[model samples]
Target: MDKVYDHRKYEQKIYSLWEKNGAFTPKVDKSKNPFTIIMPPPNANDPLHVGHAREVATQDILIRYHRMKGNSTLWLPGSDHAGIETQYVFEKKLREKGKSRSDYDRDTLYNMIWDYVKDNTGVMEKQLRQLGASCDWSRFKFTLDEKIIKIVYKTFKKLYYDGLIYRGERIVNYCPLCGTSFSQLEVNYIEKEDELYYLDYETLTIATTRPETIFADVAIAVNPKDNKYKKLVGKAAKIPLINREVPIITDRLVDLNFGTGALKVTPGHDPVDFEIGEKHIPSIISVIDMEGKMINTPEKYISMKASVAREEVVKDLEEKGYIKKRERLHHSVGVCYKHKTPIEPIVSKQWFIKVKPLAEISKAALKKGEVKIVAKKYDKIAHHWLNNLKDWNISRQIVWGIRIPAWRCDKCLEWTITDGVVPKNCVSCGHEKLIQDPDTFDTWFSSGQWPYATLLAQSRISNFQFPISKNDKAKFEDFDYFYPTSVMNPAYDILPFWVIRMIMLGLYATTRVPFKIVLLHGLVRDRFGVKISKSKGNVINPIEMINKYGADSLRMASIWGSLVENDSSLSEDNIRGQRNFANKIWNAARFIFLESVAKRGGYSKAPTTKNSYDLKIIKQLRVTTKKVTRLLEKYRLNEAAETLYDFFWNQFANDYLEKTKSRRKDAQKILDFVLQESLKLLHPFMPFVTEAIWQESKNRFNNTTLISSSWPK
Candidate 1:
């Protein structure tokens, strides 16, 4: 704790000193181009998980690298107002006090949440800072911040007035427990063993896992070419519960070999059914309600929840001559992330954005290479999403998000929409009382506009960010410099959601792609390829890792674990090895400093610009630096980190420093260059420790600080 490579003492001292001295601030100029990355802010509800830490560390490395390269860099830090997650956390807290979110009024509850979020945000910020993130903390912006909210409103109004936004009845992934509809991406599908209930539809017997949905079944479908069910085509089968006659249809959409060679079309319940409804059976009645239970399916199964109805319907089917047999089958069902409840796609009147036009623009941009995907592998993924893009449903029936600004007029019954301040009276009706729409914008609605909104705080734009001219009116100097960002480093899971949306928004607003490169990272799983989870008792606590091995060590382990493009696993042993690497750097720096400190405290000789020793290290440094930089440019973060680790730990610290220690008389020059170069290289990944030793070394050749030192060009 006193000295001697005490990680806690040095890390704390170094961070406090650097922050106080504004070490993370990158010099900005209208003339010099800037490097920028908008961080994928996590909701401040939970503690910083390992996955979150990896992203932060990766972003930090990019930002710091750019900063050292003399490019003005800004890592915009912020948090999303995660409606469901934050609401759940608050609800849990309130429940502990014997209350519910519904118990409080919306405004009062919102105020309470605002306080809660601010407090939670502080905690996360501290954790990120402790991890040595070089983000410009002074420029941090939250999604709920007044400025961001205004941007959201402005975006909504622009999109609405342009006819790209509308309200209509559509099927959405619905979770009954949460009483809300989820976006497609929010739904998780899990394969489970379910019962395949055989039901005799007159002469044709069909199998179904969800016997409850049999009441909602519009038509029993068989493959057109299936000779077995050829005679059953055009025949009507009476449903078990309501006894409503449904025609047995011949359609190629049905798989002849799947589930007794027959399929049921429940347009109101499933996506596939909805598609079939659009094409073949539009007149079919929907018997299932929003809660996934039988609504108008008759008295026996009506009003029961879907889960309860599953059992009841099957029992009745067995007793009433409808059941033929039941067999076990493996099937995939969507589940909500929070509640783990099965997600049912139910028809609902929600707002949607006409995304085809936007998607076309995005597709064109990528086709033109205006928006370059980092990994190149993402090109296929991007193409898949854009080519098969569907209209985006931007509305959510949640209380804790940006409220939809459309309002229905009492007199005219027509909706008048505005993103500006709510009108006291409806524009059409002149009614004194106007009701604000209760629906909240989907989380992605706000997220989609991040690239533009964060830059210009506007939705629509008429100009690009390049070729700076006096006549141009783009707001931020940084935006102009960094617009059409070099890369967008993010996870591949969001290719359809956030990544593609950003590209589309960029094309719509700026007539260009948001970023030229996109670095994709894989998920961090456990050693055995199983995902880390608290319930499974296999989750690694990042906080505990930090306390034991220090933040730098944990980050290094993350780098090491990121061996490939897809899912990678981390082990405690690997983290400890990273800690050892940090200790090695510290010990080497201490050794050099001790010799210099003992020699009556005078300046040591600087490394000759042309010496073989200097050239060798410099050449190696250049090769290492260039290789790592290129890798990062390509969004190969793990590869880049690996390169740095090998060079710094293996070559510089291990080989060069050991030799330099023996030649103590001329060691001053070699030591200075090695320390400076190593610090410059390691600054991105291990900021605190490097800067701590850089300051303590006392062999100052230049007046420039470690944080602002130029990267080896």
Candidate 2:
């Protein structure tokens, strides 16, 4: 052993050896239980950030540990062609070159985005390898892969035929800059200052921040509990500049205390108003178009931008005595999460999934304890979201994703939903001149089916890029064995956005829970506890840390910072501390080499010895092994890692090695036994350094690799 552990030299070499020997791939033993984790496929748009590193470290620990436990373990990997995000990123790149997506047609734009994402996906995969991820690259998948799209299409057609999918003109969160509509979950609400204008309706006074939407107001609503507006509820209120006499209505959802207790029911702009309008109002008007410009109004306000038209409308209201008073208000406004622009609520005919039924199935499974949640704190939260589940918008006006497999006939204008390809003719009208819908499915809609789809895709595809240990085992039934994966590990922040959807869709499509365990991790933050983001300039490039301190040190540091249901902080200082731990481990290996004790006995069990130092280390290793193994089994990884660190640094190196320094060979059997077992316990947490130490002792131990070694009993 070298005096110092050179991580850079040994890390790649060991990883390549593991790959060459097919240690990463699982064996097809029907006797052994299968343990699988379908990796939360990261976006294919940009290089991974620190958050990605944290995710990889957490999953890898679980994967490698399970593999050693003699389970048929699999960590399947994939990439996401993140629908709206990728298109938005591509457009930004186009702008850098003084071009726009509009400069290219749909096919040309899609092709360009595909090439860009392909290049980035390759770069991201290399980064995953650098982090020592042991996922099966042979079965790697992409969201846009023809195999994946087929599964997505299958689900879509199934839901459509089952009456769970429908097309309706409903209010959706539309981003003008992105030229796409986002689901309600995709909007980010921000608190900002705006002017609230109290308008003089003939019958009642109404206050609103958006005077530009007066043209679209079909009714004025007053809370039924508010006695002040009881008489005006049945009367009509005249609009300000539009001079339209819309009926005043009573609604339970109208707030009695919010600004004069009279609400403008512009169903075209508000989700609550849209729900109320569906019950009372017969006509819906959209004054603002999808381009963020005023339309369907008088000529003067028609072409003006919505923001510019707001000023014009306010001026007109004041000139005509329609404005009663103006006051400054600080309120929450929903905006597009990606572009940070106010999300325009517009009525668009889009595809939707009736998710409440699916949510019910998932909720029942949760209540039955079919799926276990880590930390147990998110149980009530998961139920809360499941209870409030609503219809999901599944359409995105983009060209970069799996386009909706539906066609509209030029004759009957009815849709013909098919399975991922254009039909010969419209099923509704038999029209040969049918046009396919130009929209694509929302990214989450496809990703919701990730666990089942990926496994099914793998089972169906015969060829593999890097076939793992073909001679060891032929390909067996993967989907039947791994359809319901062992664990679904994702960040807690996306628990509602992504995880909940996965459960709902999984149950609806497969009639089974996607995974038995929901092991929720948290965000990777900076030392000051802020989220590591490129926009905040706090992103610690994971590759830089791996280059500085080895990937082993980086992985250990990541596990150190993370706690259950809490954001983790990774600092350079922490990584350096872990590097010191690696050095401590290396120094112990060097000390053993210098002693020249050639008898490296692979003790299956601890030896009973009269020497107190030998007996004490053996007992400590047993207790530490049992405790650490239990913690990891329960998904308490941080506690398990802490236990490992304490046993190795404090008990083994500090006490036993120091106490037995005078007569090393006298305790060689016990010393080698404890050291080898400890290496097995720590290999899952820090693979490279521990495996390097084990490989050094391979000659004496009959050439057994630590990775393929069994867990300490």
Candidate 3:
């Protein structure tokens, strides 16, 4: 044994040995129950940050623990072709080379991005291996794989035929820069200070934040309960600067206290007004184009950006004596999550899924305990989202995702949906000249079916294959065994974006919950509780941490610092402390091995009952073992790690080892027993160091590897 512990010398070699020995492959034992977790696929376009590192560490702990407990454990790994994010990254690269996506056709750009993501996916997998994640590499799946795409298509076709999907011209949250519409979950709300414009029209007043949208106003809405606007409900008011008359209507959706008790109903520009206007108004007008430029407005504001048009319209209104009053107020504004640009509400034709029925089933599954959420506090959050769920928009105007498998006939103007192949002729009109839908399915539309698609694609069932037409049924044996996986673990930020949708779609497609347990982890933030991001200049690279400190040290630091349901802050000092703990482990093992060899001939045999020191240490180990097993069973990981740390460092090293130094043979036997059991408990969190120590003393334990060894009784 060396006098000093150096992690760099052993980490890579030990990791390679474990992989070569197939330590990560699940044992196919039908007698034991199965445990499965589908890794939340990271975006393949970027390197992983600290958040990804935390998930890897936390999930690896669960997998290793289950593997040792005699379960058929499988952790499937994958990556996502993140639609908007990947396109944004490639666009920047194109600009550097004096080219753009517009320079080529759709096929050319899609193929280019596919190659780009393939290279990045390789890099990310290497990083995961360096982090010591024991996922099943043989069962790895990608979202864009041909077999997975077939499953996604099958789900879409099923939804469409079942009357759950439809195309309609409705108001959508559109990002002009990305040229795509986003679901409500994808928009970020930020507080902004803006001028509230109160415009005077004849004898009535209308309040609005966006005077630029006045040209599209179809009516004026006021609360029906407000007595102040009762007499003017049937009257007409002229729009400022446009000289257009629109009816004054009564609707309950209006907030009576906000700015002048009257709202300009611009159905084409606002979500709340869109619903009210669709029921009460006769026509809808659009004054903004898809580029977010003022389209049907007056000459001065035409072709101007929405923000610029707002400034010019406000100036003109003030000069024309139409401004009743103005006040500065802080209000919520929706922005694109990808580009941070202000979102524009535009009415466009897009595909949508009726999620109300699906959410009902998901909610009932939670209530019935078929799907259990850890940290019971999150039950309310999951219920709240499910109860208030709206229709999901599942279409995007991007070329990098799975194209919507619908075709439109030019001769009869009818639509035909083919499950996985392009139809030779339209089913509705028998027209050979048909154009496939230009839009693509939203990225989440494919990802929501991840659990079923990934498992079914890799299944051994020969009956389930790709290019499945609408007439063919899709079923697989792997899904029958692993459909309701053991757990679904992800960070809390995605509870709405990814987790909830997974439940809803998983149930709709498979008629079963995706997982039995929903384990929600919090974000990995900086020391001050601020989220780590590249734009904030606070990003921490996990690879650098693994290079500096060993993978085991980084993994231990992550577990020690985090609670299962609470955010954890990262700092250099934390990693340093964990590194020191790793050193303590190595030194403790060294002392035990040298003492056993020198004092008791070779390895110490099991000791008989002898001294108070030996009995006390054995009793404490039993108690620590029980506590750790209970904590891990309840998913209280940090508490378990902390309990082990204190017991080994304070109880075993400081007290027992010191007092028993006089009885060399008895001390050696007790030390061997304690160290062997301790290695088992710590193997899940610190695999490399514990395994290295266990292998060095191979003659001590019948030459069984610590990884495949059973947990302490």
Candidate 4:
């Protein structure tokens, strides 16, 4: 064995060997129970950061451990076709080339993005290998793959025909910059300090944060219980800048304590106002276009950006005595998750899934413990979100995803949603002239079916062809065996964005939970506990970390440094400490090989007389093995890692190895057994170093490889 364990020298070589030998492919042994995990597919739009590294490491630990335990294990890998994010990245590249998506037609732009993502997917898969993700490469999937897209289309068609999906004009979180609509879960809310404008309407003062949306206001709202506005409930008020007559109505939704005790109702621009307008008001006005530019307003304000229009409107209102007062206030505002631009609530015709019924089933399942959430605290959060669920907006104005199957008749304007292919005529009116819906399904809409779709794709029953018969039960041997996956490990920040949707859709499609266990991990932050982001210039590249400190060392540091449920901050010093731990293991193994075995040529038999120290060490090893197994079973990975580190470094290397130096033969026998067993226990956490040492000492073991070796008993 070499004096030092260098991970860079062995990681790629060992990973390639494992891949070549099909070590990651699951063996369908009917005797042993099956264990499966569907990887939370990463976005193929960019290189992975440290968070992805940690996630892959944790998942690989579980996978390798289960495989060694003689279970038919599978870790399926894939990547997401992140609609808005991919478009954003490609658009940036286009700007560098002095062009944009508009430079080509829809089909051309879609194909361009597909090619861009294909290249990026290769880069991401290579990175996953570098991080030692032992996912079955043969079963790798892409969200936009023909087979997966077919499954997505089938799910959409099923939901539409079942009356769970509808198309209507409703307020949606619209990212003007991306020219798309997002579900509420996709918007990130940030608090900002801005001026609250108090505008003078005909007889009442209305307060609003977005003065630019005044033209869309259909009414002025006051609390029915507030005495200050009791007499003005049934009156009409003229809008400030637009001079539009809007009714003054009493609504319990109004917060009387909030500025001026009156609210401007802009149904086309605010979610709460839309609900109120839908109930009481007849007309809905939309003053802003999909591009975030002013529209359906005066020519002076037309075509101006919302922020620019805000300034112009505010200035004009003050000069015309329509601005009664202005106060500084801090309020939370929704923004696009990708571009960070303020999200505009726009009323548009979009497809929506009625989520209330689905949420009820998921909530009941949680209470029944059909799906167990780790760290129990998140159960309340999941429950609350489901209890107050709103209809999910699952349509986006993008071209690089599964186009909605619905089509409209060009002559009669009636719509028809077919199973897969475009119909010859509309279902409502037999008009041959038809146009397909120009929008695609939201990214999450397709990803929500990831667990089922990926498994269905693996089945022989699915031929990657759309319009699958509704009566045909989508089932195969693999789907039946791994339908309810054993575990689902995902970042906690995406609890609502991805997790809940997966559970709901999984149950809806398969009549079973997506996974039995939901292990939620936290964000990967910097040393200061601040989240790592490219904009902050604090993002840690996992590849750079691997290059500097070996992949095994980096994995050890990530596991030992923090618990699964808590945010962990990475530092060079922490990783360096783990590297030193790796060195200790290497040196100890080298000492056992050089001083004991090599000096005396190999031993033919086990030590006949067991000394007191030998018995003591064996007892400690048994206890440690049992403890580590229990910890791993309970998903207490950090505790398991720390326990192994202490037992190996402090107990075995420090105390036992020192005592056995004088007794070479006995030392060889005992150290060989202890080291081999220790390697098995630690292999899951630090696979490369352990595997390299195991390979060097392969003659002492019966197993062909450490990864396929039996778990420590």
Candidate 5:
């Protein structure tokens, strides 16, 4: 053994050995039960943040643990094209080069982003390897893989034929920065401070945060139950800036306490107002264009952005004495999750999925406990999301994802949908020249099908389709072993967006649960409890930490104190302490090997029961072994990690090895036996250093490699 521990030398060499020996690959053994996990695919084009590192650690712990338990374990690795998010990143790069997507045709831009995603995928896979992830690289998939796309297309075709998909001109959450539309799940609410403008109308005062939308207002809405505005409901109110007279309508959806008793109704601007106006107003007007600039208004503010036009319209209203008063207020504003820009609700033609049926089916399965969430608290959250499910907007107006396999007829304006090919002509008419919808499925649409797609792709079954009508699960070779994967481990924040959709889509496609368990890990936040992001300049780079403190320390520190489905704070002190533990492990191994192999001329055989010190530590080892195994089975990695750390440091190193140093031969045997078994127990959480120590002290291990060794008995 070396005199001092230095991890920079051993981590890369140990990982290379594992990879070269195909240690990560699983066999198709029917004798052994399969334990599989599909890695939650990360965005390919964006640099992987610390959050990715945390997930890799959590997933790897389970994969390695199951492998030592003699199961056919497979951790399928992948990357997502991340439709809108990837295009947003690529477009920012294009903008820096003074080019945009409009500068090229659809094929040209798609191919360009393909290259970008490919290059970044390579970089990301390398990072995952450096972080000691044990996912099978041979099974690595890209969400845009040809076979995966076929599955996505097939699912869409079946949904369309089943009357679950629709095309309509409804209000969509639009992101001007990304030049795309987002699903409601992709938008988050933030409390924003803004001014509330009270406008003076003839009969009543209307309060609005967006006076620029006055040009689009078709009515003023009041709570039908409010007596103060009962008479005003039948009258007409003039819009302040546009001076257009819109009718006053009463509806119960209006909040009477928000601003005034009445609110401005811009059907094309707000989703709630759109619903209300659809009932009372005769027409809908759109003044803000998709680019978030004023349009269909007076020439003075026609080209101004929404923010600039708001100031101009407010100034005009104040000068005309139509403003009653102003006050500051905080309200929830819908913003894009990726671009961080305020979402503009605009009426646009897009594709949607009726999720109610799927949600109900999935909820029934959850009620039966067919699929269990690790933390019981998340069960209510999952059930609530399922109960209140809305139609999923599955289409994105971007070029970086699987384009919808549907076409629109130029003559009849009807859609012709297919599985994986362009229709010869419009299904409704004999038009030979049909144009495909220039849109892509939302990234989640493809990702929701990941587990089955990746598993089925390994087989030659060409007849696989959705709405499975048979009981045979052996049609696909890999699916037979890996279907109903052991667990779906992902961050809790994506529970609704990804996990729920996976359950719904998986059941619809394969007629089986995607995974038996859903284990959600917490977010890795900064010390101040803020999310770690590059925009905040507080990003903790995992590779840098690996280079400094080593991979085992980083992995141990990430999973040590994290609770399931909660956010955890990242601390440099925690990582430093874990590094000290790694050194302690290394030094203890050195002392045992020196005494047993070199000084005592290779001591062997178990210590006799006359030595109670040895017996006491052995009994404690059995208890620790039982406790750690139980904890790992329960998806409690944090508690398991703490158990190993306490047993190895406090019980074995500090107490047992110290108190029995005077009994030469008996102490050496007990020391060698306990140290070897402890390394096996700790190998899952801190693989690199423990494996390195196992290799250097080869006489201690019965197996050639620590990773392939059995759990401590």
Candidate 6:
């Protein structure tokens, strides 16, 4: 029984052999078309979690299935230098040693980070390797690598030169801990219980969930179409805390049935207020600072944090003549995605990408059938975000990221941007004194260029051989060959932020859709449908699972728990079932190997008149291969894995294995065929175990390793 399938010893040995043999490299025959996928790069500071494992398994299955179908497949592998997250990690590490990031200069700290990554990156890579990722690791790219950063800067300059990127002061999300501005997608909406303060509006009353924003209110808005508040328009109302009189304006954006018909417009704090402020020029009052504190407000509230100011404002409103009544309310509040803290929309000068131009191209691409979404139901959601998309905020006030290439000369105060960097002398005044933009490009700005930036390294190394370069024509060999990649597989959460922006930038740069198909996987949530978060202590560590059971076992478990189109839970019971299934395959392989060796190559001829057992097994093999093939083509990897698992364990190992044990010759043929086909189907999911067993018995079967071998015909 190979001593109960020694997974630990065999998993590494087998994987190393596969790597040595170049099994992951595609067979580059011009006759066969290439199938490619750029993996969603994960932050390297942490190990792979259950959520990440599921995504990797899905992609691996697709790549392996396509390879078996004789298509040249390339599953490009890489990691991201997650700017904020990684910076936080290193800072924490420094803090533990009683030092801060400021102790070292940018270059010194950056070198330390690179050194840390060099030391720890192999840990996660080895974990992924154990899961049997058939990624061409030799072609791996890092987002912060010199080549990738150059490509990122080049893309940024192109957009700036084309006037698509601009800087302006606007209300944006501010994270107190990170001390940086976040994009709209970087904020997650959560329901919170709060009080709706109904304040006196002349004779009537206006209820508000955020009474603190009243300090910054520029105008009170009522729906233009609502006759109930039509008479209240063009009137003046005194703010409760600050006795400032703001004119009441009517607009259609207000929902008459929601809370009170009168809505306070805090032009410098709220998005809707910004829009209203633009329509009707009103007195601007910015009560909040970048640190989310009241900068300039009523006397008692000056220099207070936003939350503290809320309490003071509420109490003052209740004591003053403006407070009519209050009611408990539950509503969605936007919070920073990383720290889960409420985001403050404080106005600040930042770079933004005008989304309308890119959005039109994205919509046209989908409408013209250039981009396709799997499952089809997501099309409406995609369209809704695309149609109503606002301009993307693309700048961050942080130290550790790609610095803005544009510079401002102090002498002439003229903004200048060269292809790579601004010249030492100012173009206007011939002054050598120039200051680089203090802000960094947003993280998404770099990630948006991932699909093309990956090729930048190859482009540079190959001396601009790739078709994505400035001088290279789109009709060039490489672009025509791999320009429109086969598919983009990512989580559904990135639909608005990353996916849509990539579609727009890819079209602008390559003049084509980045990939032809988008495979959106649902989140790996808990059993109750709540996301497994680190704060909630519900996060499952993949490294712990790998230590207990081998990575192949953990990977198979993830595949089993995953549903093709819906969020699924990673339960312990599910993983145990997967372990048992792996054992079943191992035991069956051992039994077949012993029998065939004993009979000195047992079955040479294919059996014609088969028993019910043989027919049932053959029929299952045929049906399973066909189903898995179709499912893989459709990117239903979880379904494909499920189909293979059930057939291999239930029908073959349980019923068929016991039934055909006695009939040596006929049984061996049936077992060989079923086992071979099952391995082919399961190879992508559990490459280590499958290849280990296949290589051990290669003399009696096929010559190639399971990794590179063609699928069952």
Which one wins on TM-score?
Answer: 2
State the lDDT of candidate 4 residue by residue for 1-713, as single tens digits: 87778888888999988888789999656688889999999998678888888898889999999999999999999999988888888998999999987789999999899988887788899999998899998888889988888788778877887899999999999988788999988889999999998889978887888899999888999988999888888889999877778889988998888998898988999999999898899589998989999998889999999899999999999999998888999999899988888999999999999998789889988989999998878888888789887999999998888899888988889778865677998788798988899899888888888987887887666443322334444345566677689988899988898889999988887778889999998888888988888878887778888898888877877776677878888877778889899889999988877743542322323344559888888889889999999999998898999999999999999999999978877567778888888988999999888888877774665466789888878
Q: Give a tens-digit lDDT track for model 2, residues 107-181.
A: 999999999988778888989999999999888999999988888888898889889999999999999999999
User: How much does candidate 1 score in TM-score?
Assistant: 0.90
Question: Which segments of model 1 are wrong by more than 4 Å?
Answer: 1-3, 222-235, 248-252, 260-262, 280-286, 291-293, 424-433, 457-472, 476-478, 561-564, 595-606, 609-626, 648-662
**lDDT score of residue 348 within candidate 1:** 81
- For model 6, residues 166-251, the per-residue Cα lDDT tens digits are 88777788887677888877788999998888887564578887777777888888888878877777888887655778888888
Task: Give each model's whole-structure lDDT.
Answer: 0.74, 0.86, 0.85, 0.86, 0.86, 0.77
Query: Could you give candidate 3's per-residue lDDT for residues 135-198 as a string of tens digits?
Result: 9998899889888887888889888888999998899999988889999888999999989888
Per-residue lDDT of model 1, residues 399-435, tens digit only: 7778777788777777877655777777777886666
Instruction: Select the stronger candidate by lDDT from 5 and 6.
Output: 5
Tell me the spans in candidate 4 whose CA falls farther than 4 Å from its real position.
463-475, 595-609
The deviation in Å at residue 243 for candidate 6 is: 4.2
TM-score of each: 0.90, 0.97, 0.96, 0.95, 0.95, 0.90
| Candidates 2 and 5, the one with greater TM-score | 2
Residue lDDT tens for model 5, 232-299: 76779887656678889889899978888788888898899989987888478898887999899999
RMSD of 4: 2.6
lDDT of candidate 1? Answer: 0.74
Lowest-sum lDDT 10-residue window in model 5:
598-607
Residue 368 alpha-carbon offset, candidate 3, angstroms: 0.3
Each candidate's number of clashing pairs is: 1, 0, 0, 0, 0, 0
Native-to-model Cα distance after best TM-score fit, residue 363 in candidate 2, in Å = 0.2
